[model samples]
Target: MNEFKCKLCDKKIDATPYFEVHEWSYNEHGELLGTSIFYCDICYSKYLYKEI
Candidate 1:
């Protein structure tokens, strides 16, 4: 696990802060590549949809 900061509000938010909609790109082996990270509570509505 790693620490993540909100790109919008500049807040230091970890997984413990509770992000419901976590989006990322991965390889066929299910390894994490990169993420479209957003910090809004209603993150789904805020960030653009990513093609998985």
Candidate 2:
């Protein structure tokens, strides 16, 4: 299987029982302005932690 890369941190995603991926959509006023970005579990958690 191909390894998934995280756009947020540019790291390889490891296979695990709790592994997850994220899709971030770039929108403006309900319009889709850009392509969606993906983040591996690790980076996704860090991103959310920073927002907390």
Candidate 3:
């Protein structure tokens, strides 16, 4: 089993239920450009809608 990390919040995530991958192609200001995977539903929703 591989361990995954959320680039947005630096939370240790378990890669079992699969991951929702996102990009920082436009959120350079959020400073999450190249360090995270935006793991989980909450994170993905927040990331997609700038709820962070």
Tell me the whole-model lDDT of each prediction, alpha carbons only: 0.48, 0.42, 0.42
Q: Candidate 3 lDDT, tens digit per residue, 1-52?
A: 5555545665665544233454455464665553333334436522212222
lDDT of 2 by residue, 1-52 (tens): 5445555677666453132343445446675443233345665632211110
TM-scores of all models? 0.32, 0.35, 0.34
Clashes of each: 0, 0, 1
lDDT of 3 at 36: 34
> For candidate 1, what is the TM-score?
0.32
**Which parts of model 2 have CA positions greater than 4 angstroms off?**
16-39, 45-52
Better candidate number, 1 or 2, judged by TM-score = 2
lDDT (C-alpha) at residue 11 in model 2: 67
lDDT of 1 by residue, 1-52 (tens): 6555555555554553433465666789999865443334534233332333
Best by lDDT: 1
Off by over 4 Å in 1: 22-52
In angstroms, the error of model 1 at 31 is 6.6
